[model samples]
Target: MATRARGRGSGRHDGQPGHGRHTTATARPARTRNPLVTAPGTLATPADRALRGKAARTRVPRSAHASWLPSVDRPDPVAVLERQGRDRLPELLPIRYGRMAASPFAFLRGAAAVMAADLAAAPHTGLTVQLCGDAHLLNFGLYASPERALLFDLNDFDETYPGPFEWDVKRLAVSVAVAARENGHPEAKAGRAAQEAVTAYRTAIRRLARLGELDVWYTRIDAEQLLPLARSTRHRRRAESSLGRARRRTSLQAYGKLTEVVDGRRRIIEDPPLIEPAGTSDMAFLRKIFSDYRSTLSEERRLLLDRYRFVDAARKVVGVGSVGLRCFIVLLAGRDADDPLFLQIKEARQSVLEEHLPSGPYVHHGHRVVAGQRLLQAASDIFLGWMTGPQGRAFYWRQLRDMKGSADVAGMSPADLVSYARLCGTALARAHARSGDRIAIAGYLGNADTFDRAVTAFALSYADQTVTDHATLGAAVAAGLISAAPGV
Candidate 1:
C-alpha cells in the first residue's frame, strides 16, 4: 500500500486573462521533504524485492483494482478543469475546453487532473516509477533520438512525476478503451483492446526482470522493429508510410512550411490565435533567456547551439491539454539562408499528480520536466534544457520538430487498435523498467492474468465515466457557463 495525501495549496499568480502580456510572479522554492524514500539501509536484493512485492498483494488485492464506482462526493469534472485554468491565459482557456469537448478521447488527454484525483482515491501496490503523468493513447509516438535513429516511446512529459506505477497503466488502459469506443468499436472489443495493453505491460515487465541491468537500460523499441508486427501487407505498407512521414518531419521541413522570408530575412509565419508574432518585450525576454537555457546544456551542446544565430520567434498554441500554457517557437539559422533550426520554449507548471502523490525532487517545474524526460525516455532530445524567465516562470527548451509522429487513433480499425495498444503497453513497461524496480513489479504481477483482467474491467468502467465527463463539459459549453471555440 502506498502512502497518500491530499495535494497542498496551489501556487497562485494573478494576471489579466487577455493575450500579449507575460504574466510574472516571484519564484518560490518547492517542498524539500520526499515521502517516497525507503528506510536508510543497504539496498534489498532481487529476491527480497520480489518478496516485498508479493507481500503487497495481501494488503491491496489484485481484485481491488477492478472497482471504479464514482465516489458520492466526487469532484465535478468541469469545476476541476476550471480550477486548472485559474493561472492560465484567460483568452485561451476556451480553446482548451473546445478541444477537449471534441471527443471523450480528447477529454481523457486534457483531464489528467481529474484522473489523478480519482486514482488517489484508491489504494495502490506501492510500486513507484517516474510516470508519464498523462499516458493517454495519443501521448505515445515516434521521435528521432540524438543519434538520429527513429524510436517509439513516450513523447509527452508535461505532467511527469514519481508515483505508483499502476497509475500510468490504468491511465493507458482507460485511454485505449475510450479511443476504441470513439472509433465505433463495441464494448466487448474495447474491453479486449484494453486487456491487450495490460497483458503486454505484464509480460514485458516479466521479460525485463530477467535481463541484466545494462541490458534493461539498453532496451528500446526502434521504428524498424514495428514493421515486423504489422499483420498484413497493407498494414506493413501503412507502417512504412507513417515512418517515412515522420522521417520528413524534421526542423528543415518545419522551416520550409513555417517560415517566410520577410525583407530578405527569415521570419516565422503567423497564423492568428494558433500562431502569432511575439511582442517586442516578449522577443527581448526570449533572447535574454536563450543564454540561461544554453547554460543548462553540456559544453559540446552549447557549442552546437552557438553555431546558430537567432532569426525570429513567435507564440504558438499547441496540443489539446496544453492549449492555454505559454509556448513559443524560436527560429535560428545555422549556416546561410537555407540552413535552419527551430526550438520550442514551453511553460512547465506543477504536475497534476503532485497533489495526489508526495512532492518530487525537483524545485523548478522546468527542471522537473527535463529530468523526468531524461529518466523515462530511452533516448531524449540532445538539446533538452530548462531555464527560468521573468516573473520566475518555469520553462523547458527542446527542438521544435525531430521526426515526430503519432498514430491516427480515430481512424484505426479494431485490429489496428489492439496491435497499437500492445505496442504502447510494451513501450510503457520498458520506460518503467528503466526507472522503477522491475523485479518487484514483475513479482506482483505474477504469472496469472488476474491483474490484467482487473485493470480491463476498470478501463471499461472508467470509459463510461469519461463519456459522462465529456458530456458534462459539452453541457457546460452549451449552457454558456464556459466558452468553447470549436473546430479551431
Candidate 2:
C-alpha cells in the first residue's frame, strides 16, 4: 500500500511562506535588502552550506505556515498592471485589456506584475530557484523537443528568474483556483485541485532529490507518461486530441496558413491590428535585425539558416499578457518553393520577478530569457538564440510554432482539472529540480499535507482577490479610464 503523507492538516499556508508575523521593538531589527527588490547573486551560496536544506526547512517550519493574508503594505494591483502597459503598442492596448477582462482567470494571466509586488511584500523562505515567474495552469504545455519527441514542461519563460521557489508555487496554485472557478466548480473543488497540485510538486521534488544528478537531469514527462494519468476515457481522448493537434502544427502548416503567393513569391498575409506586413523602411531594418540574430545562433544552426532566403516580416499580437508587446514573425523560404521556415522575434523586457528578486548574471534581457528557458525546459528549440534589435531592444529568437499546444483548462471537468493540475505540478517540479536545491525544498515540504494545505488556502484567497481586481479593471474600462475592444 502507498503510504499517505501527514502533517498539521489544519493551519493555513495562506500568505507568502513566511508572511504576517511582527518583530519585537526591543529586539534588534533584522537587516535585509529592500524586500521589494532582491539584489542579484545574493543566494549564490547557501547560508549554511553543510546542511542547507535542513537549515532552510528548520527556519520555515512546515506546520508554522498556515493561511496567508495580504500585508497592509501590498501595492495597488491596478497601478502595477498599468506600469507594465506603459510604452507598449498604444493601438493594441485596448485588445490587451479586453482579453484580460474576459474572466478572472484571464486577468490572473495578465497580472504577474501585480502578484510580484504582493509576493515581494510577503514573508519569504530565503531559498531560491530558477522560477517560471508565471507558472499559471495554462503556461505548462506540450512541445516538440530537438529529437522530435513530444514532451510536457513549462513553456513560457518571459518572466523566468532566480527567486523564492514558493513564488512559482503560489502563482500556479492561484491559477488553478481561478481556472476552476471559471469552469463553475465550487471553491472546495478548486481547493482540492490546488492541494493535489502542491502535493504532486512536493512528492515529485522529494523523489527527484533522492536521485543522482544525471538521473534528475534526465527526468521528463511525455505523452506516453501522461496518458495513463488520465482519469477517464474523455480525459484520455482530450489528451490525445491535444497531442495530435500539436504534432500537426509544423512549419509547413504555418506556411500555408500565414503566407500567400504574390507575383510568384511567398509573402505574409495581411491581417491588420493582429498581423500586418512591415513597411519598406521597417523591412530594411528587419533584414539587419535578422542578420544580427543569426550571429547569436550556433555555427551549425547559422549555416543551416543561411540556406533559406528571407521572404517577409510581419508584426503579430500573441498571447494575453504579450498582446501589446513588440512581437514579429519572419518568413523564410528555401531552394525548393515548397520549403519554409518561421521564426518569432519577441521583445524581452526585464523579468517581472527581476524587480523583486536578485538579478541574474546576464546583462542582456534576451540572453537572460534564453538561458533561463534552456535551464528549465527538458529540451529546447535548436533555433533558440537571442540578440539586441533596432534601438537596442533585447529580443530572443525561436521557431514560431514547433508543435506547441496548450491545455483548455476553462473547459475541463472538475476531475479532469485535478488530473491536469497534477501533471502541471509535476512538470513544474521537474523544471525547478533541474536548477534548484531540491533536497532543501523537499525537506521543507516533507511527506505531508502541511505545505499543500497552506498553498491551497493562499490560492483560494488570492483567486478571490483576482476576481475583485478584474471587476475593478472592468469598471475602469466601462468608465473610459482605459479603452478596450473585447473578442479581438
Candidate 3:
C-alpha cells in the first residue's frame, strides 16, 4: 500500500534527506491511505479540497520550487545509469549509452532514474497524482482510441506512480526547456517555452477543478481539435501529414515492412542486434506465456484474440531507456494471412520513482504499468494487458502500432515548440485531473503565474545540469570507461 502524505510539521519518516519538511504549518489528522483508492463519497468537499491545497503552499512555498543546486552527495548520473543496466542485456548497454549521449535532451529522455533522484531531493506540494513519471516532451503523442478517434495524450507509463503532482509538471517543463535549447533557441525563449507548458497545466487544472466529476473524467484532447492551434500553414500541413501517417501505422503496415514470405508462411525478417529470430528455447517460453498473457485480457478481448493464430516472434530492441530490457514482437494472423496483428511483449521492472516515493499498490511491475496507463490515458488500446513470464519476470503486452505518432521536437521552431509544449501540458493536466485532487492542486496554483515562473527557472537550471551530465557520459565513453555504439 502507498503511504499518505504526512500532515504539516510531522517531519520526515521516509529516511531520505530533505524530504517532507514543511517550514510553517500545523498538523492535521493524517489520512494514512493511498490517495488514488478513495471510496465514493469519502472525498472532501470542493471548498475543503481547495483549502487543503492552499495549506500545502504554506508548507512548501511556490518559490521554493525554483532552486536546483545539486547536493554534494548527488549520485553520479553515469553511475546511476550503470546501476540500472546491471540486470539488463550486457550487449545492449552500449546502445543505451550511445543513444543517451547524442544530446542533453536525449540524455534526459533515458535518465528517468537520475531525474527521479533529483526531484526527490526537493520539497514538493503533496498534491498527489498518478504521474506520467517520464512526462518528457516526446512522450506526448497521437494515438488512435478504441473508437478509432485520434487523440493526443501521454504515451509512456513505464515509471508511472502516485507521487507529488509537481514532479510530472517539473519533468515536462524541463523537457521543453532542453528541447528548445537543443533546437538552437535562446535561453530566454527556452525558458518561455517551459513556462508555456506549466501555464497551460495551471490553467487546465483550474478549469478542471470547476467541472463536475464526470466532466473532468470524460475530458479528452482530440487530434482534430489540435489542427486549429497550428499557427502557420506549413505547420498545419505538417500536423495533418503526421496524423495521416499515424492512421496508416497499423498491423498491416508492420506486416509490409517487417515480414516476408518464407515457404508458404510469413516470417519476421531478421535484423541482427536489433531484431532477430527468437531462439528455440525463447520461442518455447513465449508460446507457454502466450496462454498466461491471454488470460489477463477481458472476455471480449480474449474472444477477439482467439481468432488469430501466432505466425512468428522476434526479439526486438526498442527505446532509449528500454533498449537493454527483454522485448519481443509477436505476429498473429486473423481470418487470412493478409489480416495481421502485431503485439509487443516488453519487460517491466520496478519503476525508478518507486525508490523515491512510497510503495505503489502493485506487486507486479507489469500490472503497475498497465493499470497506470488505463487510469491516466483518456482512451487506451483494447489489447493492453500484462502477465508473468518465466522466472517470475513481469511483462506487459500491447499492439506494436495502433496509429501512434510523436512530434519531432528537434525540428520544431521556437513558437512551434511552445505551442506543442502547451498542448502536451493540457493533455497531462487532463490525465492528472482524473486521478488527483484537482481542486486542491488548483487552489495551490491559484490564478497567478508564480508556480509557472518558478518551475520555468527550475527547468532552465535542470537543463544546464542535463547538459553537464550528457558531457559526463560522453567523457566516459571517450575514456573507455563505458562503451558506446553511436548511430545505432
Candidate topping TM-score: 3
lDDT order of candidates, best first? 3, 1, 2
**Model 2 score (lDDT):** 0.80
Model 3 C-alpha RMSD to native? 5.2
TM-score of 2: 0.89
| Candidate 1 weakest ten by summed lDDT | 17-26
Cα lDDT of model 1 by residue, 282-369, tens digit: 9999999999999999999999999999999999999998989999999999987788999999999989988766557899999999
Model 3, runs deviating above 4 Å: 1-17, 20-31, 34-42
What TM-score does prediction 1 earn?
A: 0.92
lDDT of each: 0.87, 0.80, 0.88
> How close to the true structure is residue 38 of candidate 1, measured as C-alpha lDDT?
43
lDDT of 3: 0.88
Q: Residue 365 error for model 3, in Å?
A: 0.3
lDDT of 2 by residue, 299-347 (tens): 9999999999888899999999888888889988887768888999899
Per-candidate TM vs. native?
Answer: 0.92, 0.89, 0.94
- Cα-based lDDT at residue 30, candidate 1: 18
The residue pairs that clash in candidate 3, if any, are none
